[model samples]
Target: MSDFDIKSFLTTLTQRAGVYRMYAADDELLYVGKAKNLKNRVSSYFRARGLNAKTVALVSHIHHIEVTVTASEAEALLLEQTLIKQHRPQYNILLKDDKSYPYLHLSDHNYPLLAYRRGKKRKSGRYFGPYPNATAVRESLNYLQRLFLLRNCEDSYFNHRSRPCLQYEIKRCSAPCVGHISQQGYDDSVRQATLFLQGKAAELLRELQQTMMAASEALEFERAAALRDQIELLRQIQEKQFVDSGQGEADVWAMTDWQNVLCIHRLVFRQGRLLASKNYYPRNPAGDDDTELLAGFIAQFYLADHAQEGVPKEVVAELPAETMEPITEALRLSIGRRVSHSRGQRGQNRKWLVMAQENARTGAQAQVSGRQESARKLEEVKQLLHLSDAPARIECFDISHAQGEATYASCVVYGAEGLMKDRYRRFSIRDVAAGDDYAALEQATRRHLTRLKEQDDLPGLLLIDGGKGQVARVAEVLEELAISTVALFGISKGETRKSGWEFLWEAGAATPIMPEAHNEGFRLLQWVRDEAHRFAITGHRKARAKSRSQSDLESLEGVGPKRRKELLLYFGSLRNMRGAPKEELEKVPGISKKLAEQIFIQLHGE
Candidate 1:
């Protein structure tokens, strides 16, 4: 149906495994996919027969296709996931969940505390178990506290404690805060807990048993009883967890569809114990069958950067052996080890597989029930905004900076489904005076609108994260660009400077529009504005950090690499150089008196 020149394109396609992207006439991304053979997989979409309804619909809009060759199918899979996350093409199945997995963090302290942590790992400590979810991390922390009695209190709280707290009375903590447990004794407990978390439970249990025996032989009855109780708890955990001596680590996956809603359930197993379970509902616009969907999910799941630390030794699924071969090969290429694939025909593997399958079915049914809520909310947004038709797309802009430096403008996109992260963009504010938000907004809007005008793809509504002044500035840009199809509005914090008390300024209006706090449309606007603010802040922080990390002398005129090296060597460090007077700077090789004075004035603001 599309004038894509499929025959000409196929002739030039390669047979190697790689990634392919489809685009519409307007240059909008339609889909991104990986294939074992680029030539064959892409050809399937254009065949005369056997094409599904959704695939045909996608092909009908295809203007052209682009391909990137990779060394292996595994590499292609990784690249495919990265592009999908970045662009989120219309014809591809998109996984909405993006939060990082949680971990059990052990602080680097004399008496360390085991705590649940998420996000970037910047703290100095040992991190273990990038568990499936926060609940798994918390449950593990509770078990460790019960068995080892390690402190879970914050360092500040521990430092200021005057006496044993309620946790000590309840027997969950040994009250390291009150010196009830010696540093050496707490260190031993920490070691045992670490061992258990590292999946060396048998080794830890044996060590605990030996310690208990020694205590009993030394006539330390109380110490022996405590050790014995710990051993019993460990044994109970082993039994209840269904510990299998043979299996070290594995993941079981099951996918099911109910009323066109698809769900994938995953069960993670580490050290023969079930760690946690997760459910994913990806939007499948092309209507891929079970095998294709399962394979895609596997590639995206295991190849993600967050998942690299937790790749298992095996995977259990119901997919055909042929379908799993490439997946196994790709995973091996990614993790530097051969990860076997199992059909889960019998024994414990089969049982885990069955559980995952049932969970997937249940999750799909639940998703079907909740599908209408999103539509209802969208309708409410339409009524609140007084739009004749529900908007297909909404874009918001926000500006962020530290004082007058490292300014960044962020544009976030929201569509019918929700936040469209792939469509988000950040513009570094340049040529404008630092901290001049009006000029920054004008520049960013001019650039963004110029591009949209070329592509003929403009959003229905444009929102600004500021008061009427900001909206007027952007409106001027729109007028300059001769674009008027988009409706413009601005959001500003109310006098209280709190959420749910925000004022909105419609374009060309002298006053702000105050919507009720509980209005769904107002809440949607709040969500988009907050997202834009967050994105801008993140970009600004990264730019600020990078600017700070660079040498201060780089910004000075007439300072090249050779001059910088000479200056550093003469002064030994930047700190010493900054302290140098103009006379002292003049003594450095190739440093003229005038240049030294200039450098001194710039560095010291003298």
Candidate 2:
């Protein structure tokens, strides 16, 4: 047994529906399971009693577990199947074939019947899907039947019908056999249903919108409302079916780094079905860009002797063509076959790429969730700082600005439990010289420390994103406040001004300590520093954008703060206000006809 911290992990585990993956000591995925409540389900394996020999063996080897939350149990089930099929973990009962996968079959009659099917596609006029399961297919079929009123009856039963069936009475079928609907009308319904099945949502929505408008123009309000309802239902379906698509073949590659752990996920599609997926964690010693990493991985992957047999005809990623060109050329030469590389900017390819990216991000997060890695980093921090015990809480501060405008300082909190986002604070630097980072840091630190002092709740260590000068300013703040419990350090970029070459300055120390590039403690510090920088920069940009967005309105004559607020409130946005006609502008409260005309003329430059 690998001493898995079941009790501690369970404390943070959520009671939501999700998929949980169990891993062994070597980071080998052993099992994947879905649960209605993640906390209860995962806890069952570690109970004190009632374990079978196989279950005991599986639990004994468990090192850590990771979870991906879903909105509902159905979604969790679907994602569970996806991960199971992709990884085929040793403890999972793998499906030997795609025979059990369900599909939506549209028959060849005048009023084509949409029905749930499995196994062979011999009787199909069009097979829309190999949906994850029969339930998903049935749900889609039920929705489509309601939206388009397409029939769902056997051919023999349809041919012998003398009048409308119950399905037709319920408005789920158009009853083409009894002439309740014209052939032209039934064909149009079939065409619309086809568009929905094929995942041409945009085109289908456009046609629906046009029909709704026509109905409105003819004063058929009831029909227009019904069309509107149908459109909404179609949109809902689209949101749920983001991964659903028609026939295609390609391989998707995505890479992501989470909590300093890098993961790359590859998804393979054949005949529009997800055949397999796998994850890789290549060492990123040089901290390469994603493009460089992906290019290298793709080249090495396809050039491998065993990989040549499964080389896809097309490869899709979130990389540009120029970056992938060399790899594509190399593949052609080595394999004597042409392979296309795509960015997957739109349609089904984009969806596949997005899914791959999401999986990569989640996989990286899972790897980082392992307690051993986190404990190692914390232990390194304790040794580097010469502390008797590992610090439970560390806070980092950074200042950001554009030349001399929209100055903001950000504080990010980190602890054994990972980032404490709720504890993060942003200070809008005031009464300080613009671009004077020292002043901003002093003000931000004084304010943050004052609050912490009153509450008697302070972090174990404080980090600043600058050198001795910045550290001195913060030290002065601590002295003025008469606070001495927290240790303080400042990190400054080395001469090359790159990551992995930062010099750390202790409070009141003249000399800076430069740790080795690969030190875990230094890496943890870098991650915290980078996070503070990102948060500060993001806050600064939002402040700058808000100032710039209001600049135009502020400059307009007779538009004081109150009037500007009213104009924005009434029009919803500046763009809408600019486009509003004078007559509409006059309708707003407190805007006279003369003022409205003047406003229009100024807005239009007329």
Candidate 3:
């Protein structure tokens, strides 16, 4: 809760539209909502009732407020979700713990390929899942790989496999690229894999088991052993099967609010077994009803990783009647399945739904407890900056380099009282002459400023990690860009460049806000400065690696300008090239077999 008294501030409907944010003491943006009347909508929060005890606690923390007027409520909602996802405020129900969802990726090739993947979907392929967790999707992929036997090897490696790989010797693969298996056998394997993913795992397993028994009876021991292994693996997976319910894939989501926080838990049953269970905690759901929060959480959660496979035939969630159709239609199109939500009626199924709700309650409580330290640190920052309003969103910058080579700048943000690491950004010192610190600083600042102008949101405060010189430099950049109303400052080193004596750089003089032995403000700035330094150093390391790769390519003889690029693109990097044999190198567009052999010898002395 912010310190700003919602009870005291009166609504004048001062603006037709604007973005309103509700934040807690830790400066963590709890909830961001837009209004048709900026003041009227914001003022309404003071009178809302039935708010959870947790919600009241958060409201108690409000110390300051700021507003950015927009022209539309639609713009406000859009900004709200974006910031919620970006900062992940405490009051909004947020997906928990998982860094990313998993997917089953079918690789690009004439033969095609299948594998389990996570992170950004940059490669060309048909991806599915975003299953409850990585393990569930991975189990599914293992089943498919064993059934399909499609080559999972990288293209270049598969191309160079003159003999059948271990997968072939083990009978899991037909080794089509090396011609050990006929095109027909490979196609049959692909068909079975698809069926297993489409709620036919049990049927597929029975067929595979039967084949194993037949092979053993025919004295094909090796073939039988391979089949036996696949059978055992499949049997061991997804042990929590539902015998009473009709066999089909489905997802069950349940939500509960504790204090002002909401938690959602999902139980995913795929192929009639409980595949995975997950929990999500969303922030500052103050004044928002349970049904609304549940609806919004489900939409954003699914969108975050839409490529996952196995859309449950039904999605069971505890929500109001109105949300059901829109959710069903939206998911149906994305997953190509008939999606529906169910309310628990009695029996074991009803108990499971209760279990999902309990999970949500526990998760929300844990998150609120864990947020304490970060909140205290944020309050300290507010005091140290002497900001007119305590900044709920603060952005800090730092520069790093090794002897001025491969210079880089990093920006890290803290919101509502803690760091939002995902919004962190790194900028390569482009357009700046190498080794020129001032030029690098100027370039990075301008790029950041320009983007901020284009984007609808900006940080509440901007901090640079240096003395007066750095502060002055940033101010000049802002002035040149004609931006006003931005809080800017620099942090200078203390006595002997230690923590305690640091000064805040102001125009014309260095103002001291040195930390006493236990000053909260001093400790807070130290933490921020340290975090910025770490982020900047990490960026500098990455930039140096990229530079080294380019230098390596430039040094290769006969690789010249055009051929160098072709090699890098084909192989991905110099490391890949160094590992490549002559035969692999010959595939690069401009490289002949003779030239490839020369390269192999020159690089490896082979």
Candidate 4:
């Protein structure tokens, strides 16, 4: 147990609140901990006798220790969770949160954009739900499209529309791009949609009634009919809303542990209605008691801000008696607000806890079975693809371009957990033919394959975006690199250019090999391919935007990044820049009359 030096590391431990990590002799992480006093808490392991069996066992393997100081205990709790997630320390209870729920985001604009998001909420907009399933979010979005007719296209797509697209033709959108809907009309629809999301059906219905009556009174029978239809839809939706009494917002948490497996179910309520439930499997959460686990999870969960829409005002949980008050106080300090952490041991709260517990038990068993199934499928992939071993790391590549402009390539990695985002990379095509997809892929492979020259880090499977031709190029690149063990393949869009129907190819193979459509191997390949396309498209869009903006601004003398930004901010857009009067340009604070004239002449191409 004394395999490495732990005594010297303990000498440097600070007295301030922070998190500490202990590593075993093999550099394997043993545990992660947060303490109000690092020196006191950490030293207790080596200095204090009569330690708990778990701490005693963990300290014996602790060949190394690392500490990170924080401003407060609350910050330390967050940092501890983050480190646990990254390292998956054997002696720590880590939350195994794989999926993030989707939210329906309504953009703040003259004509709002409706879309689905599952990442960090960085944009300022109206967001609803951490919906349990993506299908639910999509369903809600579809219903909103039918009732409100808000635009659901990207800003770039919206900006380029010369006329209404299929969404407008099908009556799902008001065609704001073509001026088919007035600003006031679109604004009203956005307001109504917001009210619907907020679960204010009664108020929204009353407002709709007034609007409908006024439309009828003004002899606008068509508009009145439309309003009447919307009202009927709202009533139907109101009937489906959940019945709950938590004063609009509350989060319910309950847990179940079978043997050494632990699962926690979190049911979130917004506007007095159930929005979604999330299940977590904290990594190796076997050693701790229920109270310690609950306290640690509460400190990490609420403070993490992992879910959208911010923290709820109330958290109802089936907590061990000893941990309730301290957990509540910790949450208060973390959020700087009086957040209620109620023990769901009685009344409606108890019922909520019961439901969550039942779900937790079921979910934990299901999660275990799912991991087993995924492992089996990976083995199947190895045999099916004729690989040397089960592929643990699969890398997929794709190239995106608009005709012959703004070429970009993306490399997305798929590991056992699916979509290893941290390993994904994007490459900009320089001095290459944008239309030549094969050459673009070759460049991407050469760049990526060169970096993974080490024996272990190179992917077991190499997936290219296109068929036959792309496969040949990848094979050529792999040959040039003098690497041969990696299994290279390409996925081609079939005759219909659809998902499910895509063709697969092995390196240098002219004929396509077909895996059954329902096979897990096929589905996994499709998932990686689709994700690669998505990544490539996003990078391509950004590259094109940057190139256009830079070329336009850099064409002018003395107009660098800062001045270009200032002019763009003042005028709002390139269109506005072209239209501004010379006098107005001169009044832009930094622009002299001579410079303004030059700007006008350059913009107008005089």
lDDT tens readout by residue for model 1, 22-131: 88999798998888788899999989999899998999998866665443454355456656765788788887656787888899988888888877897889998676
Error of 3 at 78 (Å): 43
Tell how far residue 320 is off in model 4, in angstroms: 43
Candidate 3 segments whose C-alpha is farther than 4 A from its true place:
1-376, 454-456, 499-501, 550-606
- lDDT agreement with native, every candidate: 0.76, 0.78, 0.64, 0.72
- Runs with alpha carbons beyond 4 Å of true place in candidate 2: 1-20, 23-113, 118-136, 149-191, 198-201, 211-229, 235-264, 281-361, 382-390, 400-408, 427-440, 494-497, 514-516, 537-606
Q: Give one digit per residue, the lDDT tens place, for model 3 in 220-256.
A: 9998877766654544342222321335566778887
Residue 565 of model 4 has an lDDT of 65
State which candidate, 2 or 3, has the greater TM-score. Answer: 2
Looking at model 1, report the run of 10 residues with the lowest lDDT sum.
236-245
Give the candidate number with the greatest TM-score: 2
Q: How far off is residue 380 in model 4, in Å?
A: 2.6
**What residue pairs are clashing in model 4?**
94-282, 94-283, 96-281
Q: Which clashing pairs does model 2 show?
A: none
Estimated TM-score for each candidate: 0.36, 0.62, 0.35, 0.37
Task: Estimate the lDDT of model 3.
Answer: 0.64
**Candidate 1 error regions (>4 Å):** 1-375, 550-606
